[model samples]
Target: MQELKIERLVKRYPGRDQVIAVNHVDVEVQAGEMLVLLGPSGCGKTTLLRCVAGLEDAQEGRILLEGQPVFDASSGMNQPTHLRDIGMVFQNYSLWPHMTVQANVEYPLRARGAKADDRARRAAEVLEVVQCAHLSDRIPAMLSGGQQQRIALARALAPRPKVMLLDEPLSNLDALLRVELRAHLRAIHRELGFTGIYVTHDQIEAFNLGTRVAVMNAGRIEQLGSASQVYERPATEYVARFLGIRNSLAIDPQGGWHAGPTPLAGDLGRLDQHQGPMQLYVRPPSVSVLPADAPAPGPGQIVLSGARVKDVLYAGGEIDFVVELGQATLYATMRVGGAAPRASDPVRIQFASSDALLYRNGQLIDG
Candidate 1:
């Protein structure tokens, strides 16, 4: 079993405009847990992973594996990459075109000075685990993107390193392959019980693959929590927006909601008291269609009485309603055959106030 910890890690690029690629980031991963680092393209997630893999130098900080320090800036002690006992899966498959799948997977064990029998056995075992045993004789150039990805994964796990670092390993695959391989990777993690840190810009990959996700922005970790907590109850305005929550209302201390060009009553419970400036978000799925005859206020319900259905869009399996609540336009996704209205039709929308997440400065304001 392996545990990894990063302390006050900082990586910067010195140029005309000096940029800090990775801020003072700190995180830890327990044995058998996959911690995912998620953010935009330039959010420093990749750099952080690279720093962990010893592929990038850090100006300051310490990294520990199983309580042993691999990097200690104060002591000027940085472990060489080959001695870190880490496995890396890159964005590109990075498989050798000339080598067979078996040979590629055997490279790690071979470099570690394992016997020919040990290398061959380890490579075959990992290839079978990744479901690419049948393709062991083929070269990467003859394989599909998904197959190549499997080969890369097998190669990384062949040596059974203490920790695995994956940097957008599935970003290059097609949509179908990405979905298929996500399940494959998760299952492999469960089977092998290896600690890992994954970096990706795709939300689905982050939420589905990670046991805990760390959302980063501008070289800093904005929020770190379970997938449900981060997605359902985002802590920051940046996180909410990044997660694609669209329903927003700016409210004053008096409970008046500035919902676009109009005003609505906002009952934020404790947050309504002495509020300076606060933003609230209601997830689209939480927004529901109200009956024509108004129902009594249910527990946690917040009703919008005079909303108009501006448009109804059909997208494959679900329908998206472009609802106009006064001057505010909000989107709600519902399954097929729901109580959908035509364009310009009068409609009502309701959602539980508890579902409305409050945030100020990209941080959750718990009531």
Candidate 2:
């Protein structure tokens, strides 16, 4: 069943420098699924989430929660945020500093007029679910950042809301804590099976938590798909770049590909059917730099000969090689412990043609 539906959503700021926050966006989140809105700042992802929670009044759209209309612009019906039955976990954790963890977790149920005993029981249950039951007696200030965020999650889950909206809830934590809490959040979601919409600019978080990811840009969703689908085969240049597939080369009408003035060699058998100018995108890992004197590549592989190594940087387990092909630069990485190539070394860049992502007019060409 569709737990949440957002249709034709349009939100705009009225001023001399008016901005369209959400532009005719449509999304349907299935029950028990975590739909992640993945985008950089100012991409309208947070605005869309706020609209669903009834925190923002969109100029045009209809928001439905489990088949019930929460906001319908055409009919002029706008359900207030409190009545929308959404549990939101904010970036700051949003715990009352003076309240005990137990009180913080039970506050929502208490506000809904649940009996004291019922609120206590529900809070305890969710606290256990979030692995924060032992911290019930401590105030927010007494707990660690991770513990506080877990308590915040417990609080949100205590009321058994129809939809849980998380707006970058882990952003405030340190990198190590973020990873630890991300695992906890995924485990909790699996155990509880609550419908969720998570907003984050972190690609790793989106890939780790979302059942489906919507990559947004400039007030619109550029691509929506599974983590592998979005990561391996991004639908547009924006999504490709955002996902770290940074090598974008221009493919001419004659099927020749180049980054700057230097032409790169690739199998053009697949490009015979594609017309006009095309863009080819490939991930840095997909590219490999070899000695210029290396043997010729086999079929279905792309090879750029006479490329000069501009620089090499050690990045943890991998070595990043900045290769200059004419006036354009392309990045390639290889595992460390190998004979490191120095700058100005003549190298040949290579990658498989099958890994190339070809797009025309900003849309991916069907393979």
Candidate 3:
């Protein structure tokens, strides 16, 4: 089994002061694991991945692959990219237009002085592994976007690299193809058992492909956890908002939370210990909208009245009803085949305090 470890990793770009692309990052990826580096653009996820692949020189850090020191700034040792024995898939297909798919896939083997028969055998094996055997004879221009990307991936895997690094490999494809290739990548990773770091800004891709996710922000990891943990229990307000949780109201220092024009008569609980001015976040799915004729909820359930349906949008499997609760507008999703309120319709909303997440000083306080 292979393991990749990074300690106090830092990468910076030369600038007026210095632009830090990775800052004191400490993380590890166990064998057969896919560690996803997820963040919005300019968040330095790609830079961190590049530093690990030996493509970028880090100013400070130590990197270990399978207990071998590939990079150590203190020792003044840095291995070149090729010698690092890692595979990389770029955002673009990066295929040679003039070369056939077979030739492209075999390029790595040829570069390392492999004989023609050995290169042919390895290229054929990977092309078949990537399900591109039929397209192996075709030039890049002759194949579809998806096929070309598969060939690129085939090339990356042809050498049977121990560490695979993919930088938004599906970003260039259309939405449907992106999803298609995402599943393919997941399957390939599982079958090959290569420790990998996949970089992408798309949340769906991050959640779908990652064995564990490292949410990067301004060169630092804001949160590192499973998909469920990261999505349901974000470490910070930035992550909550980035995940599209919009039902956030300010909380005052006196353990009193401000929910627009609504009063906070409920128990403050853990939020009381926090300091001044925080944010309360809630997912739309956690908020239940009661029909006009429905009965009230049991004890401890927060029931807010005087809410009117501002808009109704059907979202395939669910209906999104925008409700004006006091001075704020909140959204709630209702499953199809249920009683859905339309525009101008009066509605009641209910949610438990446990579902409400609190954030003070940008970090999660209570949920």
lDDT of 1 by residue, 59-172 (tens): 999999999998888898889889998899998999999999989999988889999999999888998999989999999999999999999999999989989999999999
Worst 10 residues of 3 by lDDT: 263-272
Question: Mind giving the per-residue lDDT tens digits that candidate 3 earns over 45-75?
Answer: 8889888888888989899998999999998
Cα error, candidate 3, residue 144 (Å): 0.9
Q: Look at candidate 1 and tell me the lDDT of residue 13.
A: 95
What's the ranking of the predictions by lDDT, best on top?
A: 2, 3, 1
Q: How many backbone clashes does candidate 2 have?
A: 0
Task: Write down the lDDT that model 3 would get.
Answer: 0.85
**Model 1 CA deviation exceeding 4 Å by range:** 253-277, 289-299, 336-339
- What's the C-alpha lDDT at position 206 in model 3? 93
CA RMSD (A), model 2: 1.6
Task: List clashing residue pairs in candidate 2.
Answer: none
Answer with 1 or 2, whichever has the higher lDDT: 2
* TM-score (all chains, Cα) for each model: 0.91, 0.96, 0.90
Model 2 misplaced stretches (Cα beyond 4 Å): 253-260
Rank by TM-score, highest first: 2, 1, 3
